[model samples]
Target: MSELTLAIDQSTQGTKILLVRQDGTIAYKITKNHQQIINPQGWISHDLTEIAANLKFLIRKALSHAGDAAIKAVTISNQRETAAAWSRRTSAPLALAIVWQDNRTTKVTEQPNIKKREKIIKYKTGLPLSPYFTASKFNWLQTYEPAVQTALSTGDLCLGTIDSWLLYLLSEGTYKTEPSNACRTQLMNIETCEWDPELCEIFGINPKNLPTIVDSDSNFGTTTLFGTLEKPIPITSILGDSQSALLAENCLHPGEIKVTFGTGSSIMMNTGQKLLRTKNGLNTSVAWKRKGKTTYALEGNVNYSGALISWLKDRLKLINDPAETDEMAQAASKNDTTFLIPAFSGMAAPYNKPELKAALVGMTPLTGRNEIVCAALDAIIYQINDIISLMCQVFTDSKLTLHVDGGMIANQYLMQRLADIVQCKVLISPIQELSGVGTSLNGMNNQTLTLSVSKTYKPCLDKIQSQNQVKIWANNIKQLTK
Candidate 1:
């Protein structure tokens, strides 16, 4: 019998468990939904209990499909930088699981305490001094959380990102987190690969309470309490979703870049051994670590991409299915030059303008639903193009091909438009959920997953046109801020 690898790709919305053979090919897949909590003024949180239940369900189903064989390993690629403060005594979250998109830390993000250490954090961590990361969320609780605040005064607070929370529960509170997951917390030192006590003290986070930083391929623990899988499954690898996808892309060498067009899009390029030491909003993320070495990357983010498509369906009443983006774009008048800035919870990455609201510009009296809807779709792809260009500029001017994946790539219009706007070669892989595919690759024995050319969207626009459009895009960004 072939050995199977059970891979879990958990996001804020739900948990997706897949059954993959030892050769890195997916055999079967199952996705289970998760619950989100919206507080008084729209603070988003995940019920870990609800998430755990969903996880157990998917894990069992995936295992059942895999049958009665000892699996290779159970790997996880989690939504990066989302935090939860839970109790060790009781396997319960003390507060809400502050989503990466949640802006509850808006006031505290500008606090003098966090401000004082912003530069130092950015310099060391390669991340912006923004509230989207775990540091600001942890700090926000110190001020905003009455119960958790007092609990911290004692010794009852165990704060960790989504990966850590899930690992703790899965391991039955035995295994900790890996270095790649830990580094995203902002509390960990990239150089030392450990939680910096000084940084922790500054942010009111205790380094001791944090998870241990292990190798990328290290065995974190075994699943005891999770699901109905009778066998004790070993939990081996853990990775931030984007980093895992980067690994999956096999962009091991420096100057290689890939863009994940998920809910909040990210464009990450491998920076290799030396840190780029960026002062801009570009993040210095720990790509992955193995054998006493680390792979570093510089990332530029577009926090609203595929999510905006969902908004078009549910909120704006544009299309019942997101597949209409292709049809709608084909249906739209090409002359319609409308634009949308989907800063629903503000922008991230190169422009972490959390306070900035969404915008729809250059609308004419003749602008109908088709043009308007098409514009929103184009604008989202345009924003991604803007960020990818910024990433190339910030990281390196190398001849880079963007490896594209996620649900949005199904929209050919956006992919073609992305190729045009960015003026680069965009390669879409046959596999869509590449983040989990990457994590499972670690467990594979042979058979490298080659980059199959599904379609190569080349630069269709001339340099002059692209530059002029980018100039106007920047102007719109500035004016909207003012």
Candidate 2:
């Protein structure tokens, strides 16, 4: 019988379950989107119960078509930094999962105590003292949510990212998290790969409430998915979604890079074994840890990328579907100079301004739906180009080529525009769901699996034109910030 690995990618938007064959191809795939719960106060959240139920639904739906293939292992890749708190005794969630995009803890992060320790926190965690990470969200829950408070008082609080929550659910109470997810929490020390007590104290999170840190390829435990499968299978691997995409793109060597254009964009360059801290706005994080060896990466995050398209579709009603963006952008007037800065959740990386709101500039009477759509697409490309330029400064010796994946890459116009603006070759992954594939590859221990690029986008604009475009974007950004 053939062997298969069930890989689950629980991301910001939805949960995807894939039955991956030994050769790294998906045998069966199913995805179910959960509700994006936004409170009246504008705090974004995820119903953990809904997400867990969706995962169960996808698993059962995918496995029904597995035929007689032996299900060998289960792996997970999840949205990093989304915080969750639950009961250690009852295994019930204490509160809704606070999204990484939610900035409800901004006030907490700006407190006199936390502000004074910003440098120390960044030094220890390799991340800025911002509410964008898991630590502040955990703190917010502990302080504001009544159930979380009650759980904490009774010592029943289990604080973790989405991976640990799902791991606890699937592995029957194994409270564990891997480095890729842990590093983003602003609680783990990047050097030691353990929860730093000082950093934890700074965020008012007890180290004991956190999950056990483990290697990315560790066998977390076995799960039968609450009897969804015929037998219990070992849960073998876990990684944050961006790091998983890095592994899927074969960016194992120093200076290699991958860009994941998901709900948000993460531009990560593998720094190999060395942990390099940056004075610039870029974040240094553990790419993954395996076999007692840890790999580090420099990451620049864009708070809005594909989410911009969703906004345009769902809110503005400019486009009925995300796929329509390509054709609409292509049809837009060439002379239109409208630019959009999608800082809806505030800008990240190079300019970590959570205070700035989004803007649309340089609009003319000629600007219409097509032009606005084009601008929105260009906004995503410009944000990515900003990070790519920064990475170029850090790795000056290497020529950067972005190995790209995620739903947004399907937009041909956007990919070409990214190539033109960044003035580099862009390679698109054949598989849209690389996070799941990467986790499955790690679970199977298949180092020799070849990754095939389905398409390549080369720079079409001349050097001068590309430079001018970048300058225009920079100017717009300066105006927004000013």
Candidate 3:
């Protein structure tokens, strides 16, 4: 009997469930998208109940296709930094979960005291005092929502990330989170791998309200997910989606990097054991912890990437489907000098400009749908290139291996363009669902992943041409910011 494991990936956009066999092959997979829940206040949210229902549905659907495979355990990879406020007694959410991308707390971080203590906060948590983190959103809810305040006062509030919410619902009562997700809350100390008392007080979050931190691969609890399976499986692993992909790519060595393009993009480099204190906007986070041993990573986040392509299709009506952008981009004139700065939700990492709006520059008479489509694709590449530049600054080692994964990597043209602009060899992972695969692998003891490069994109442009193009883009952005 071949052993199997179920891996659930609850992301910003949707939930995916995969049944992996012992032979390192996915026996079955199911995906379901949830509502985005945007409001007039420009806050982004997810229906936690809807997400949980979808999780149960995906698990039931995958298990039906999986036959009688002997399942070993279950693991989860979820969107990091999205905070959830729930009732401890009834397990009901107090309000819509505050998404990581929501900037409602921007004014909160600008307070004199917060601005004054930025250096101290960053030094302790390895994260800046920004609205992008979970603590800020958590604080926002506690401050604005009357129900959240009441729950917090009554000690019935369970403030946590998506992973903890799912674990609590699935296991019927286990309130816990792992380091990879906990580190993004801005309340956990990266060095101690525990909730910091002073930082909790800074955010006005009580330590009792936070979930107990655990190792990445530690048992989250046992769950049947509302009897979707024959037997309860140990919830063996939980990790933030990006960090899970880092492990899935097996980027263990210092200077090894993996870029995951999804709703947003995260460019992370393994800095080994030593925490590289970066003066740049890049963030240092606990990559993972196992058996009390921890590893660290330097990460840069871009608020827009593949989401830009979605906007072009859904909002602008430029393309009927996302995949069409690839061919349109290939058809675009190479000489056209159009550049798009996708600051839809403000810029993050390296730039740190939250007030800047997006811009499309250098259009000409020949600019059309194809050129615009190409510009969107180029925007994704350039945003990723910016983060890669920052990661390279810290890891100055001559040889750097770049591993690429995500749904967007299917575009060979875009991958080639990314390689050319970044001037690095880009290796595409054959697996599209690396986050789920990584979470499943985390649960396995002494299991070695055999990852092979499906395709390699090498730099096609000369260094001078690449430099000039980047300079042009930067100049255009500077004009817009002014």
Who wins the lDDT comparison?
Answer: 2
lDDT per residue as tens, model 3, 1-482? 77788888998899999998765568888899999888886778988889878887887888778776777888899999898999999888888998887887888788786778888789988887888888888888899999999998898999999999988888888999988899899899888899999888888889899889989989888987688666788998998999989988988778889999898888999888878888888899888897778989999998877778878988899999889988999999999988988887778887877767788888999899999999988888887787788778777972465799998999978899999999989999999899988888888862547898999999999989998888887787778877
lDDT, residue 99, candidate 1: 88
TM-score of 3: 0.97
Give Cα-based local distance difference scores for all models: 0.78, 0.90, 0.86
> Superposing all C-alpha atoms, what RMSD in Å does each candidate have to the true structure?
1.9, 1.1, 1.3
lDDT of 3 at 158: 93
The local lDDT score (0 to 100) that residue 370 gets in candidate 1 is 86
**Candidate topping TM-score:** 2
TM-scores, each model vs. reference: 0.95, 0.98, 0.97
lDDT tens digits by residue: candidate 1, 1-482: 67877888996567898777766778889887676566677687777778878888777677677766667678888898787887766667787678888887877668788788877787667777777888878878666777677667777777788878888888877537766677777888888788888778778777756777787777778875364656687776788889888888778888888889887787888888867777656778888887668888888777777778878988789888988878888788877767788888888867779888898998888888888778877777677776677677776655568888887888888888888788889999788888888878754531257767688899888989888887877888888988
Runs of candidate 2 with Cα error greater than 4 angstroms are 446-448
Considering lDDT, where higher is better, how would the candidates rank from best to worst? 2, 3, 1
Q: Name the candidate, 1 or 2, with the larger TM-score value.
A: 2
